[model samples]
Target chain A: MLAWAIPTYTPAYPGYGASPALMLNVSVYVMLFMAILSLIRISVAVYTNRPVCSEEREFPEDLEGDDGFTQVGRMNLLHLARVMIPCVLLVVAIEYIGYALASFAFLMILQYLIGSRKWLQSTILSSVLVAVLYIVMRYGFGVPVPGPQVF
Target chain B: MEMIFAGLLDSISPASLMFLLVGVAVGVLIGAIPGINGPMAIALFIPITYYMTPLTAIGFLVGLNKGAFFGGAVSAVLLRTPGTPEAAATSWDGYPLTQQGKGEKALRMALYSSVAGDIISTFVLILIAAPLAAVALFMGPSEIFALISLALTVIAGIGTTSICRGLIAAGFGIAAGLIGTEPVTALPRMTFDVYQLGSGLSLIPVAIGLLAFSEILLQLERFTVKGDSEHSANVFSSKLEDRLVSFKEFFSKLKTLLRGSLIGIGVGAMPGLGAPVASFMSYDQAMKRSKNKNEFGKGSLEGIAASESANSSVVASSLIPLFVLGIPGNLAAAMLMGAFMIHGMQPGPLLFKENAQLMYGIYGSLVLASLFLLLIGRFGLRLFCKAVDIPAMVLYPIVIFTCIMGAYLGKSSMFDVGVMLTFGFIGYFMRKFDYSYVAFLIGFILAPEWERALQQVVIISENNTFMFFQRPVAMVLMAVTFFVIGRTFWVSINDSRRKKAEQAMSAEQAKNG
Candidate 1:
């Protein structure tokens, strides 16, 4: 970050009192200092509070529910993948299948994955929603939706 | 007075009224559903507002903001879950009231209290905003820089558990803001030769990504992992009298209502303290002052009044700084600032001089929104309560689609969509790490102005830092900034040490036992 903050263009404009990159440099450098301090603090705390060696060590129960840091600390990678993979695929699918078809599929898939166990109901809902959205946004509002590149 | 009347006429026009009504309805629907918030809704809808006139669009958003506060309390009273974070305090008494079969009465009280607080705050905003802007007009770049510095520090200190993490998030935000072009030289410094980044990251994509898209991802995780738990929304009381809040009953708690509104206004006027803090503080104060203290957690009307009023009042009072100094008081206000800019209006002291009628028009709409909230909350209460049963499966998918559409429609650029996706992940991680995304957002929004002010100060001072001393206001603001940072750090350190000592003693006690 410090190296990136170095001014690439040094020639000052007439009456310009400071380097153009002055604010940029200050922000980056201060952030670096704070980051280092935080790292040191974390290191010291961890060192001082070393875990006891035992065959049957009891882990503390995480009381902070879904609203807190427990979600991040013990991240379910598979769950994340399920959510993110579809999102990424939707972006790609939009280019290939157009916005309406892609959105319908994405919505149905996400709904099914998230617990709408009945596939037929999810499909009908997704289709009606996509059709209405496409008509409203494209016709009513005149906002363009992506069309299939291949078509 | 003439200008105020003209603004009122404009805001009451057919087009303005229609947009405002729709915005309020949409906002209420969004807020009544758990997992969506006012900021996220505003972010998602900003792209849609690209088609409307400036006054109409702003009035619509303001109405939306007002409606959401009241809407949040609906779920808090009906279900144990709060639709918004600020409503968490409301659920303490509100949910208990639901359990006791006075759910209708509790919801009514929450609505009445919310509207009452909103009207009072809107009135206060109208009374003070112009004068505050007039005073702000006298400040120079040095004072502005100092003021921004103070705001950034205070927000970082109060918006998070750790001031260090908040400031770090803000630092990264400022750095992100520097990526497009150098103001003085017109040279790109941090663009890394990306041609698309020459114009910098667009505000719509960033806002929608951070506030809306990231939220969708979080909700998705919660739903998929936790397995959607259905909340029972069975209203126990079917009696008409139990559902109604008489005027006498409302007036009986006037003291609590007034106290909560005042606390909300005071907190909301300050940047970063936000509605959650204000609502909790009001709840605590009400508990302390209440004669029947035991009723607080056991379905007290006063407790609901305190929490609802404080959170609702914050919706308008938080706009005080945004209107006067062009500094956003919270995340929603920051998004409003972006909306104002998109409509070709800057929201500083000059706003009064250049667009006084428009400002007054917004004020008129704000008052109108309170009335609309009352009407909607009275009639649409049952309909919106059903929003909680919409299921995470259905709602999350739709929200995700909206996020995609909002990001895509901003500039019709694929790169912006990619930026949205990237920032969504960044926001998710930031929230997980307990960083104050509010501080990050405020920092990002204010970075350009901060940079401009610094540049001006540097030129005026001829590279000498001592000029701040000659300016008393600037000097004082800078001093206060340092003082706040030092005080926050000191308090944080002391708190950690106390916690460590307590833990050690508990461990020793366990060993002895």
Candidate 2:
């Protein structure tokens, strides 16, 4: 399933003299080879009764319940959902709402989600940050902040 | 001598001096803030430097790099949070010193050592860059490819805990770099027909996402923990003078500083090994050689000196490869190269001959910047120390916003923002899996050069794949690469064996009990 998503050298543009995908092939093949090698090593280790995929040494006691090495603890999932979901949403939101508004929304929601109890304080700070960033990027630096064409 | 003097005068202009000071101040503030680093800071400021003179602009950036090195130590000491990865080793002893109410002393030691290291390494750069460039001028594409390959191997070996993971990360990075249109054919290889991907991923977004946004996510995880919020509030709340170190005390650690500076210079001159590696290596060396070995990781001043000096020295010496060969040693140097290109200055052997005055001026600026870093760092320590007290909730969100804005500012592309977010997720997973993101980043950065050189080599050899083996330098590098990979694997195997044996012995003891 994962391999399908990994881009391979397709030789798409045949008319262009030499294959332009040479280095691409080199990189993809090397990665695929390493992944296979790792899989084999792990299989051998498990089969030989000396499993090397254990997280025992990689993590400390405090992090023992969390994922390390090959361990897929619950915390990894929680963290992924907590962090990545918002980031992904922010990326999507920026295209629709614009950078300033999306950033303000993102910051406030992030703060709230992270357990910031001072809602008013978080709102003010997030608003101010968004405004300041908008001003600096849009006006001061002349870098266009993604917004309505009128702006 | 006359050109040196002229260059010195050129660098000391009021406008240049002002920019240098401003750069140091800005760099220190950014560096002292957790989740921000020199490369990100430089990337953010590169657009601003477009309007300034080359001398003033490069000087300001160099000063920023130097100041950030010391500034990173500030957060490491006072908050046990390294503002940059290079400061990770400093936090080992620095945080202990802070716990013992010697935070100011640690900061002062970091400042002095940073300045000393910067001075020595800047002088070393001045002395060796032209000569190295002269030597490098004679090298062919094959030789360059060999050198770059050696760099990749060394980075893969030293940058991660496992050789497999490191190589895997490098492969992925190279693959990522190969996305977009192939340089020679102008045909897209891995873009999957996405128009934005056809232009290739810009370095700014990828870097900002990897270093900054991933860090923001990590910090968010910490902030979610109930105890961590209260802990952040209380950080660096003690009286300032109680933690101060005297001049005599700082001078006592000169030997350690010198040793670290040498190590940093050596590592920095190498193409791929960076400040974080040098700092940790120096700290390890210091711990091994110390009479009071037990004092390490327990408020030892020597530990702070070792890490601070080595990391700071890397700032100046890392430029040697960049200036002489036009090949940046690290991300920060790559940004500086971008600045150079923006200013119409190409760095290489011909640059020394064609732009001697400018080169000398840059050398002068480096020395002046070191002085500025010391001055700004000494006075601004108290101000930056307060940055540790800022709530992560307030700080990180603003950083996240800035990161997004910075990415957009790079090429004014929403596509870059998406790239940044994607890499942020990738970086987060990479960290969790204990893969070396540094090696990955270096691989991505070097991939274009690698591809170019490889293509050149192929053409020169008339498609003979084995021709590289005939070239002495290429053969030597290939041999070294194999040796390094083999050694790393062997070490891992031995380590696992020892660990298993110990586990078995412990099990037996438990059984007996």
Candidate 3:
């Protein structure tokens, strides 16, 4: 079962100018084509008695149970939070504290979050890593490392 | 000839040599480590190249690319875990050899074959890319547009398990690619009044996000969901005979080596088929042709040669399209394209004419890199084996820091850092959904050129959408796109129906039992 359809895309700002958005229109057209193709794929999957694009095997016995799925989902979310929260904080730190101090703190925090329970060990390692990186990036390579804003 | 000599001289300069050596070492270390590969390393290091000379930077990256291929086989041989997908077939015979205490023999054969393949294919690149670029220079905009369309169709249809997902990923890429402004009119289209986005998203941020950051997230999830299963990389033999291959023994497999290189070049030149495919194909051919086929999975030197040679050769042959037509044949090549553009040189026919010296310099560096691979792989094998033992907990966090630094260095804008984070999440979801990120990236890389060619076609055709009929090449390419897409859909539908029938039959048989 195959089908083709074009979805109308209203521009975010319609009154920008008199010039046509030829590129955007073509992009939208391609996206619409993709949408139609996806719809067909979903429909065929359902009709064929397959799960909707599920990567799971057919045999229930071979599959991870609902509980397993929930546990995996929970673990993934936990892992993501562990990584992303520290990442966001690190970026915020870099904004206020400059590259050297921010990088040292960020690496220490990240190493801890990734399961380094030894604070002194992680701090020493992080400091050395940061110093090396700062020297290479700032002095050796001449790329501008971010400095704290005075304001 | 003088240009070639000058290029060779430049490649052999102290600074270039230093960077290339470092690139290869880092590449090998990364490739030997599980859950990291060449593309990630290249993406992370690209921003650092902002300060280096063009020849040095590119030579460094090329060395990285070459070293990673051989490095991947190290883990495959010693640990039974392929560090890169391209080395998946290597693990088959390599692990068996390890079990038989011939791991050193397997490693040496892999190194020799890899260098041989890389050197041969590098020569092939020198022989072909210029003439092909000259031919590509004559292509009209309409034909170019049609060719890009055909390339995208093939990549979307063949690159992923699901054609719909691949095409949708490409569509999303095109949408993202159109975010900044319309090229012809210079009118902002999807910027939503974010002045920072008046210029399109930077390549470094997006690439770092997609290739490096997302991979980190995936690795984190992998660790969380399934605890890391660490493999020890211990060679089973210390015998001199087992550690070294004689010249006569290496030369005995010349047929297998040459055949693998040829298969690699053929497959690697295509847009979607990549090193993994070439390696597996070469391995299968070697197995089929060998008189002692039964020995293949039980530690055959020919198997290692076939797999390693083909995968390593792909590093250079995959550059053929990128150098000749400005179309990257794979993800690594695409990243290289981004690097080229970052260095203020566009790849294509103009590169051959305008940067002939640079081109020859790059070729010289590639050959040099192969020799470096041989030297490094021979001497530093144990060091790289130890690299595989680096804990994920230590590695992932450090990778994140580098990614952040890489993103920030692109434009010195914290905004690009935000962009990188956003794309990181997008890349995570894209991977979860089995979309072809390769297709997405290629689409993104080619989007500007595609739009320009399309605009030219429109103006040349006077708004006639069917103007393809006037250009035979364009018409044929378009037809091929349609035909391939149609065939892919047809095959997919038939496969689904067959699976459904088989499932029903199996259920019936189970019920009867």
Candidate 4:
């Protein structure tokens, strides 16, 4: 994505330019300033052969080792990827399916990824939460909440 | 003698007395719940006040605020989970005391400290609100702009978990507030042409999304991964310290309590920076000046006293800016302002002159509310300590349900349901990915004010951009802001890194076990 700063360039504002111009000007300035500052600091550290902050060492590879769930570094990214890729992709594939159905699909995928077979409980809980969210903001506050309409 | 006699009669009429009792009862129950707080409880009742006398309505609001203040401390002390954000800081020391089997004693100190702070601040609110409002009448847009800038600076220093992340999060939050409409011309800035996008995001739904719903979602994931059930415990057995401390102990904390109260008052005076700042500042100041700083996180009784007193102290002081300057100091106060407008009373500079008796009613209510807080807090301490019995399993579903109901109750739209989930998703990702939710809130609150201020500044200067620096207050604020940001970043980075290191060590120990 193209990064930009957004300036409030109101037509009435005299000193302000076009909205896009101001945004580009600010973003470019900040991005360049930060990049140069970081480069200078990095060069100084490397050229001087000085101590630097090391991220990988401090991250503790065994974090969540005792945490009943999978550790971040050790999780089989391939297996996890195999499961998530299709489930996420399938969401858009079912174009005729309603929003509520899509929501159900999302819950099923999340539950399975987390290694839960307690389908009934997960379905009940997720459905109720979605329904309440549907009723409250949509009906009570005159706020338009999203849900399955075509189904 | 005449003033005391007359004031007592006027303050304690049958009608006022009835309202106070009802307010206290409602306060304790609402406070017992996790989401509804003292200020919010008052705000909810503000609209209903149209049906009652001013004295009764004010009495109810004040009494509720007082009761909720004490009620929140109870959950913090006994459950180790604070019912409100202010009480969250209290749990730093208060919860440890509970785990160490002194929950009852911690509850007592919290009640005593809360009562002491509320009474002192109520009196302070009475004497200061009108005079401050009068002074505020003379402030032009320039002064308001400076004041807003100073508030933003102060918020940066108010103990965020990380200064850089907090600042970035705050910037993002301001941007979020900018999304709905341009303040001057009502032109839509960022709405993608959807009719609903122009209305912007609703705060309550966003709060429900961030604080309530997403938290439940995360909690549910633990059930499968861990595959272990929790064992429930009894509520009010041995945790009570059984010793009603002597007046000597109370008197010993008097100075500390007063110091904490002043910190609370100062933080409360600034709108948009509410009780959390007051509590943190008071607790930090107390630790700095205390003889027992080493015992702060390890069930220190004095720490509990300082945090509770200062946190509740914000209730009245926060009202000062709201009434005097027509600026909301926090989300709860902003909601309260909306409710007041519903009651046909404009709470600003004109409030005192236009409605003196109503103002007096408010003052009387404040004093009465604090008094009732002490009475109910002392008696209801035992009952409140029982909430910890709820295991995470059953509570998550109920919380999720209530969050949905609260959103629906305010507006009966289904699309807002999707809005809630979307924000909930955003909130979860932000917090999970290291963004400050409170900074986002601050951005939302100050967006309109900044826009209006900038517009006025532009018009007044007639395009002389340099004129912004010419104002003395603005320049001083800007300078102080730079210094505050630098100092805040240094301390925040150190504190957070230390906490992370400590957590890492604890995880290693657990893994070994």
Query: TM-scores across all candidates?
Result: 0.94, 0.88, 0.93, 0.68
Considering the two chains of model 4, state its CAPRI-style docking category.
incorrect
Alpha-carbon deviation at B141 in model 2, angstroms: 0.8
Models sorted by DockQ, best on top: 2, 1, 3, 4
lDDT of 3 by residue, B1-513 (tens): 899899999999999998888888888888888767888788888988888899999999999888888888878888888888899899999988888777878888999999999988999988998889999888788888888888888888544667887888887777677667666667665676688887888888998898889888887776755665667647658887777888988988899999999999998899889999999999999999998899898888989999988998899999998998788888899889989998988877779889999999999899989888888888988777788787776677678888887898878878888888888888876776567778888888888788888877877666777778999988999999999989988987787677767767998999999
C-alpha local distance difference test of each model: 0.82, 0.78, 0.81, 0.62
CAPRI tier for the interface of model 3: acceptable
Superposed model 3: Cα runs more than 4 Å off: A1-20, A44-50, A53-72, A149-151
| Each model's chain A TM-score | 0.69, 0.73, 0.65, 0.55
Interface RMSD of the predictions, in order shown?
5.4, 3.0, 5.2, 7.3
Candidate order by lDDT, highest to lowest? 1, 3, 2, 4
What is model 3's DockQ versus the real complex? 0.33
Residue A79, model 3: Cα distance from true site in angstroms: 1.3
lDDT of 3 at B52: 85
Q: Which stretches of candidate 1 lie over 4 Å from their true place?
A: A5-17, A50-75, A148-151
Which candidate number maximizes lDDT?
A: 1
Give the higher-lDDT candidate: 1 or 4: 1
Model 4 misplaced stretches (Cα beyond 4 Å) = A1-151, B1-69, B79-102, B156-161, B218-249, B270-303, B321-365, B486-513
Tell me the tens digit of each residue's lDDT in model 4 across B440-498: 56555565566566567767877576765778777776677677767875775576567
RMSD of each: 3.6, 3.7, 3.8, 8.0
